[model samples]
Target: MTWSIVARDPETGHLGIAVASRFFAVGAIVPSMRGGIGAIATQAFISPLYGTDGLMLLADGQSPESIIATLTDRDDGCQQRQMHLIDGQGRNAAFTGQKCIDWAGHIIDDDVSVAGNMLVGPNVIAETLRVYKETEGTPLPERLLAAMDAGEAAGGDKRGRQSAALKICRDQDYPWLDIRADDHPDPLGELRRLYAVAQERFLHVVETMPTRANPHGLTDRRLIDEKIAALEAARIADGRPSPSFATPLKPA
Candidate 1:
């Protein structure tokens, strides 16, 4: 019911997962990652616990293969499960249950795993890997989203696509950028648009940091006070009252 790629961007040390499915809200189920930890995709029988458990195992310093083996060993329904994992070191691994529906399988590469069950064909996974590798020069999330789009174009879920998602995390301690498109007519497309919006927001946050820095060594304290006053006025005009300070000018 799902097709997904779990991967590490070797150049950025960023971990990400992209998934699309005939299932509703696939994002809520398949993709998972933690900053500086690992990424995992669990589908088919779709054990959600594996996401948390796998990250914990990686955090405990387990290797990717060992973590996957332990996870598979503990699950009684392993044969019906599909999973792809990547550790912090960019090591990758994947598993597809022999009992999965027709056209089910996975492909593993140096830092990525692409897998799908009940797909239109094995080419879904193949095309996903090809796109990921070919788009290596792009940002991790954009490349992952492109891979999902390519898989969908190659014929994704046999039942047809309903939802898609992209999750990525960095070692820097801001919130992970997790975006989803559920119950959309073209969920993967919507997910791509949302990812673009997220990129803009990330840039806005990054730009705000520089504004806080004192770019000039000017000792005129009054200039700082005047700039603060102008900023407060602008915020008030924008219909957002300042939480910290009162309006510089009193109400008439």
Candidate 2:
């Protein structure tokens, strides 16, 4: 019913997940992350509690395997559940329950996990990992998107696609970057397009901000001068003339 990837960019320590399913608002249920903590994706007998509870365990210094065991041990429904977890250290773990529907499986790689249940084929998870690893030199979101595209191409959810989502986070004031395309006919493709648009918007905003607020913190004095010049030009264009000074030399 769903396919997902939970991953960390080793170079940047950024955490992210990409997911799609024949389900409504997959973003709301399938992805969860906290800055400087970890990320979780729970689906197929989808246990929403795992998202919060797992993060709490991670916060308490639990390993991914230990956290997974605790959750699976407490739940009688574990056999039908699927989950993927990645810790702050980039340790990854994933599980697909025994009773899940056909073509259900998962792949755990270095700092990443890909999982799916009732998928078109077992190759979905494999292809997801392949794409994630092979698509290098790209931003975290772009790499995640590439993994999602590979899963879709390998035949995603057996039930078909309804919604898709991406979530990424870093250690910043506002670390979450989430995008979703709910109730779309081609949700994965739409998600990819939206991700590209979002990247463009982010770049545009960065380029437009005052230099004093930029990462370099070096003011662009020329830009300020250009703006002042533009304002004066606007006033001149509107036919507003400067006042002239007069002298009284004859009276003197």
Candidate 3:
């Protein structure tokens, strides 16, 4: 019913998860992450506890493999669930319950894990991992989207697509970017559009928000405006279009 990719970006140490499913608001339950800790995607008899408690275990410095073992060892319904994770140390692991629907399984690699249940076939996760590895230097968010797109092309959820989500956490407890299309005709496509819309102004503001290093984030409106203008100017000078939700804004 769902497939997800959880990864730690080697370039920036950011943690991210992207998920899609033939279920309503899959984002709400399938994906969870804490900046600087790790990420988890729980589906197929989804358990929100796996996400919340799993992060606690990650914060405790437990290995991804250990965490999965501990969690499943305690859950009586473990055989009906599926999950995957990537810890802060870049170790990754995943589990597919024996009782999960056919076509259920996962792939784990250094700093990344892809898992799914009720998917079309093995190529779904295979293509996902392939695209993610191929786009090495791309930003984590874009890379995630591209990987999921490839999986969808390879045959995503055997049932159909209903919702999708993309979440990225750089170095804070909260997410740097989190977007969801709870229910849509083309959830993955909607996610891409939402991400593009985020680039327009939302992400610029996110950069100025409070973080651990700077408890008092950039609060001066004038300086914030200047910083955004500078970035936009640089983009234009490089022949890139301005970021905008509807139309690209012309450089002033």
Candidate 4:
């Protein structure tokens, strides 16, 4: 029903999760993260508590392995659950219940973990990890997306695709970027479009938003506006396509 990647960017210390599933609105339920803490993806039977409680454990300096054991050991539904996490220390771990559907398992690497249940086969997670490792220098968001794209190519959720999501967190309690294709014919493609659109304007605005380091953020908009203008100019100078818009369809 679902497959996901939870990773910590080695270069930036940013944490991110990319997930796709045959279930509707997978994004809202599958991913949870706190900057300077860790990330969690809870699926299969879908215990949201794994996310909330898991973060508390990570905050307490609990290892991903201990957190998973503590949560699953107490849950009656552990056999039907799948989860993975990576902590601030860059340690990672994953779990797949024995009772989960066939083709369900996980892979844990240095600072990343990939997990899934009811996927087409093992190649899905394998290729996902492979591409993620291969794309070392790329930004966290794009690297996660590229890995997911490879997983999909390898045969994603066996049932089909319905929703996908990408979340990135840097040094804030909230995400740097959180986008979803909750319900769509091509969820990942929609996510990519949204990511492109974000680069045009939304991300620049996000950069100006208040954060712990800069409580005032950028009260003046002039600088941000100039930055965006400069980027747009650079694109044009490079002969790149202009900023794009998703136009609404006219009534049939």
Model 3 misplacement above 4 A = 227-252
lDDT of 4 by residue, 10-97 (tens): 7788999999999999999999999989999999999999999999999999999999999999999999999999998799889899
Ranking by lDDT: 4, 3, 2, 1
- Candidate 2 lDDT over residue span 208-234, tens digit each: 443423556325657645655575578
Residue-level lDDT tens digits of model 1 in 121-208: 9999999999999998888888888898899999999998788888877764232578788898899888867765554334334323
- Pairs of residues at least 3 apart in sequence or in different chains that clash in candidate 4: none
The C-alpha TM-scores of every prediction are 0.80, 0.80, 0.91, 0.93
Please give the RMSD to the true structure for each candidate, in Å. 7.9, 12.1, 3.2, 3.4
The candidate 4 region of ten consecutive residues with least summed lDDT is 242-251
TM-score sort, best first: 4, 3, 1, 2
Weakest ten-residue segment in model 2 by summed lDDT: 240-249
The candidate scoring highest on TM-score is 4
Write down the worst ten-residue block by lDDT for model 3. 241-250
Residue 15 of model 2, lDDT score? 90
Cα-based RMSD of candidate 1: 7.9
Global CA lDDT computed for model 1: 0.81
Candidate 4: misplaced stretches above 4 Å? 233-252
